[model samples]
Each structure stands twice: as structure tokens, then as C-alpha cells.
Target: MTTHSATLREEIEEMIAVGELKPGQHLDETELAARFGVSRTPVRETLIQLASMGLVVIRPRRGAIVAELGPQQLVEMFEVMSELEATCGRLAARRMTREEQQSLLAAHQACLDARDAQEPDVYYYKNELFHEAIYAGSHNQFLIEQTRNLYRRLRPYRRLQLRVRDRLHNSYHEHDGVVQAIVSGDGELAAHLLREHVMIQGQRFSDLMASLPQLRQGAA
Candidate 1:
């Protein structure tokens, strides 16, 4: 994708994630094009791609609306993410290179620094890089591709969870455990810890959703 399209896609995704564009809300192509200061052609193409990604729904006459998130989908996504991260950890324990291990440690340290500075966005992105380092270290291209797809699908929800108080600190600790297990070449321990770490996010999301009246009302 061209830079314009990629930026448009990211903007739209961010808007939806932040609730600027709510689920089931229609998206106006002309408005998006004007807001983005780009032509409608790229916007239209981006919408189609977003629709394919299940971020939006495109109807013949009604244009696009944000996709709804239900409990079932959330559970399914967590299950998939748990499996993917576990597999990545398992492979990484056996296959990780010295440079990859160093990179993972560096990324984790960066995340810790970002957390100390109270920069959630920077910490979140660095956390992503930390996980991506493990994924790349797995040495399994097929697993990497599948995990990337699942990670993208869950990005919005994951980003939202970053705002939960002290989540950054807790996540850093979890990443430390994962790195320790991997560095020690304990594949089973690495896999178990990774799955637990990822699944805990799901539990947190569930608890957060339960406590949010607006979210409950929306689901109702």
C-alpha cells in the first residue's frame, strides 16, 4: 500500500478504536477524504481493505459502518492470541539468535523506561516491538504470518487495555518472565508463561467491560 493509503487506514483504525467512530456508525467517504486532505479514490480503496479486515462493514447502498464487537468474538480472539504467543515463545526458546535475544531485552527495557515516563503510547509501541522480536525469533515463517494477522485483528482492543492503570508495569514484569524462560532455553516454561501473560489481558478486558455501564448498555 502507498503511504497515503496506509496513513488513511491507520487514522481510520485509530478513530474507531478511540470511539470517535462507534460501532455500527456509518462512515462518509467524502467526509473522510476531506478530513484526510486526499482524493476519494484512496479513501475508497482503504475502506474496502478495512472492510476485508472486519474493521468495517460495507453495504451496497449504505456505505461503511464500524464492526461490532461481541463477547463471543472477544473470547475467540483471546484464545487465538494465547495460542499464537505460546507457539512463538516455544519456538523462540530453541531458535532465538544472540542478536534477537539482545533486541528483545532492549525493547523490554525501552518499555520499562516509557512506563517510568508515563508515556503509554511509547510503552505500547515498544511492547509491540518486544513481542515482535520474539515472533521473529521463532524461525517459523508460517507461524509468524498467522500470528501477525491475529495480532493486527486484536490491536484495537489491546491498545485500549494499555490505559488500564498500572497495566504497563504489570506487562513489563510478564515480559521479563517470558524473556527469562526463553533465555534459559526452557521451551515448556516459556510457552506456559507466554500463554498466561496473553490470556491475563483477556481476563482484564472482560473485567473492565463488566465494570463499564456504557459497554454493557451497548452490548444490550
Candidate 2:
């Protein structure tokens, strides 16, 4: 794909993430191409890329639509995500070098600034850098690739969670523990902290569920 295709894909992904493109909403290639000032070929390629990332569904006759997951599907994906993150944390604790640890600390400090500024979008992008640092610190290429793919797939939901009351502060605090455990080389503790951090349970789950209706309404 060219730069145009990549840019198109990101724009569409952003739309889906922020609810401009809702679950199950049809995505007409022609319309998208016109909207983005691109050719239909690039739109088609972009849709295919998004489909691989589990963001778009291309049907035999029905064409493409934004992928829709039920509550159960969401839970299952997050369950896998939690495990992947835990493994990354565990390996990072054991494998990261001094330089990598310092990088991770830098990422964490960036997140702190974003949290204090009450800028969820800024924090969201910064949070990606923080997690990516840990993923790279794991030092296993295959695991890093798999973890990154799933993390990108789950980006929108994670971003949405930041908008929940006090979630930004709480998330930063959670990162603090994760950083400490990894920097201390406590693999078990790091794994445990990361698992809990990634899991959506109790009130967090309720908050995410409550936010779905508003997302749908935005599309409507």
C-alpha cells in the first residue's frame, strides 16, 4: 500500500474509534474514496487492511461494514489481551536492559504529564508508546508482533475507557506499579499487575457497557 492507502486506513480507523463509523455501518468504497479524495483502489486496499486488523468485515455480497462484536466477543478479546500484556510484562521484567528500562520510565513520565493535563487523547497516544516500550522490552520478536497486532485492534476500546470518570488518573497509577515491578525485575509481580491492569471487570466493565449506547447514538 502507498502512503495514501495508509493514511486512508488511519482516517477510517479513527472514524470507527470515535463513533463516526458505528458498528455494522456500511462502508461504501466510492463514498469513502470521494470523502478522502482518493481512488477506489486505495479505499479497497485500506478496507482489506482494516479487515485483517478486525476493524472491518467484508462480506461476499453485502460489501464492507464496520465489525461489530457482542458483549461476549468483547470480553473474550480483552481476556486474550490481558494475557498477552501479562506475558509482555513478565518477559520485560526479566529481559529489559538498563537503557530499555530508562526508556520505559520516560514513557511513563510522559503519561503522567498527559494525565495531569486531563488530555485523554494525548494520554491515549502516549499510552501506546508506553505499552510499545514494554512490548519491545520483551525481546521476543514473535511475541512482540502478536502483542502489537492485538493491541492495535483493541486501541479504540482502550481509548474509550480513558474517558470514564477518574480512569486517566487510575490508569497512570496502574502504570506506576507496572513500571516498578518491571524495573525491579520482579517478573511475577509485573505479570500480575499487568493482568489486572488490562482486565475490564466490575465497575470498569459496567462503565464500558454504558458508554456503548452513547457511541451508537453518535453514529445515529
Candidate 3:
């Protein structure tokens, strides 16, 4: 909550975003403290917060390490996200205000512009905002919180998927479909489409894993 704490949190998050702190990599408290010109106390506090967010894990003797990205975890997150998004869409269709709909549309346009610029990372961030706008529009606090948590959990893998061949364009098209369904106030259609949209990532991960011999062998 303090300015120093906020800065430490932001720095840690940026490290994760840029892949400097990769999955399953240990976080060196002494090194981080040296880098930030701070004491171990603040660094430890920041690590604890990150761990609470499921971004890092603090073990008894091992300190904090980046959380491992497992296929099962990805599947579980997507399954939960799909259900949350579907419920959000369904509720938004029936309860959204005019301003909320416009806000969602605006976020979608921002995503389109980012896509046009061929900035996949920017597009992905905006795309998250677009879906999050919809979630907020649903006016379900519990759903919003849960969806945000899952989104954070799957952030790294989602970033990886954006780099897949033509996935950016495909994602754009899917967002269009979701917007159309929501705009038409077709709750059932919107819910179903959103569910499918979220699940597609899981399928892609499966296909990706299948194509990687090393991953397949590791699984066995």
C-alpha cells in the first residue's frame, strides 16, 4: 500500500510480464533487494503478495519461485474462465446499461486497432480489457473477482498463445462474434459463444503439446 511497496509490486509484475522471471525460476531475495536498492523486508513482502496472487510460490527453505505452468493448471483455469465468462455474458445481455455496452464496444475497437498495428502484446492486453469490461457490466462482484483471478493465473500462457501462427487474427474474429452476440441481447448465444471462445485456447494447448515430442515424452 505504501509507495515503496507499490513500486516493488510493479517491478515484480513487470519482470513476470517480460519473462525475466520465468516459470519455475527461483526469486533470489538478495539479488532482488540489491537490484531495487531496498532491504529484504520489502522484497519479502512483495514476494508474499505475488505468491498470494498465484504468480509465485514460497517454500519453507526454497524461498519464492515463479509458479510452474502445467497443462493441468492451464486446463483448469480455462475451464473456470469459460464458465465465468459465460455467466458474465449471460448476465450482461440481460442487465447491461447502455454506457456499459458502449464501453465494451470501445474496448473492442481498441483491440482491433492494436491488432491492425500488428502489436500482438498490446492487442492481447486490450483484449483482456474488452472481456473485463463485459465482466464488469454483468454487475456480479463474485464473478468479476473470480474471472480476474483466473485471468491473472493464465496470463503467461495466454501471452504464449498469441504468438502462435495467425492466432491474433483468429482471436479478433472470436471477439467480434462475442460482441455481436452480446449486442443482439442474445444471452444464450453470447454465453455459448464465450464458453467456446475460452475453451478453444485449451484445445490449442493440447494440439501444441501433442506436436512437441519433448513435452509428450515428459508427460509419459
Candidate 4:
């Protein structure tokens, strides 16, 4: 994306993330152009990009509407995401170079700082970096690219999930377990820890329903 389109993309995404744009609401290129003080071309391009993020759906001759995932779909999506993360962790445990391991530790520490500073938004961004590092450390280029794509698609829920009560603290401890397993080259333990961390099963699923009603309600 061009710089202009990238900026507009983020603005539109933020609008969706904050509930300013309800699910299935149409995004008119001309209207967005006017709102953002840009031409329709950039707005069009941004909408297309959002579609790729699974945040918007470009319809036939109908422009774009916010994409909505139903409850079953949400659960299914998380299932796949969990498997992908587990695979990354397992691979990273064995493949990560000493330097890469240190980088992952540093990313984990950044999460610690974000939580201590009472910065949920800061933690959110750092959390993405932390996961991306695991995908990278997997040293499997194909898995890295595939995992990164799905990671972007699921960004909003993951960000909101971090805001649930003591979730930051819980996630920190989860990271500690995964980090220890990876540092010790325990692929099995790392994989299990990461699967549990990302899957949002059992109590974690309940936590999402409680904290992010919009996301959960859409599925219902």
C-alpha cells in the first residue's frame, strides 16, 4: 500500500475496531474519500486491503461491508490459529538461533513493560511483535507467511482479549511458560503452551464473551 492508503487503512480499521463502524455496514468509496480528504482511488484501494484483513467484504457491485464472523466461525478460526501457533512454537524451539531466542525474550520483556506501565494499547502492539517473532524463529518461510496473514485477520479480537481484567498478567505468565520451553528446546512443551495460549478455549472463551460482547454477539 502507498503511504496515503496505509494511513487511511489504519484510520478505517481503528473505526471498525472501536465499534464506530458496525458489522455489515457498507463502506462507500466516495463517502470515505470525502471523510478522509482523499480521492476515491485511495479509498477503494484501502477497502480492498481491509478485505484481505478479513475486516471488510467487497461485494459484487455493492462496494464493501464490514465482515462479520459468527460464533461457530469464530471458534473454528481460533482452532486453526491455535494449531498454527503451536506449530510455530514447536519449530522455533528447535530452530531458533541463540540470537533469535534472545530477541523473543526481549519481545516478552516489552510485554512486561507495557503491562507495568498500564498500557493496554502498547501491550497490544508488542504482543503482535512477540508472536511474529515466534513465527519468524520457526525458520520456515512458508509457515511464517501463512501465519502472518491469519494473524492480521484476527488482530482485533486479540487486541480486545488483552483488555480483559487481569488478562495481561495471565498472558505474561503464559509467555513465561512458552519462553522457558523454547529456551530449553522442549518442543513438546512449547507447542502445548502456545496452543493453550492462543486457542481461547474453556474459561478463555468465556472471558472473550464477557469482555468483547460485540465480537461474541456477532457470532450468535
- In order, what lDDT does every prediction score? 0.83, 0.90, 0.80, 0.87
Candidate 2 lDDT over 100-215, as tens digits, reads 99999999999999999999989998999999999999999999999889987877788888988899999999999999999999999999999999988778989977876686
Candidate 4 lDDT trough over 10 residues, lowest sum: 211-220
Tell me the spans in candidate 1 whose CA falls farther than 4 Å from its real position: 60-62, 200-203, 210-220
Query: TM-score, each model?
Result: 0.87, 0.90, 0.80, 0.90
Q: Candidate 1's residue-wise lDDT over 159-212, tens digit each?
A: 656766777788888898999999999999999999988874456876556544
Off by over 4 Å in 3: 1-24, 34-42, 60-62, 200-203, 206-220
lDDT of 3: 0.80
Indicate the worst ten consecutive residues by lDDT in candidate 1: 211-220
Better by TM-score, candidate 4 or 1: 4
Decide which is better by TM-score, 3 or 4.
4
Best by TM-score: 2
Which pairs of residues collide in candidate 2? Answer: none
Cα lDDT of model 4 by residue, 1-220, tens digit = 8888999987787677646677889888888899889999989888999899899999998779998766577778888999999999999999999999999999999999998997887998898989988999999999988898888887777887887889999988899999999999999999999999999777887877676556444433
**Model 4: CA > 4 A from native:** 213-220
TM-score of candidate 4 on Cα atoms, chains taken together: 0.90
What TM-score does candidate 2 reach? 0.90
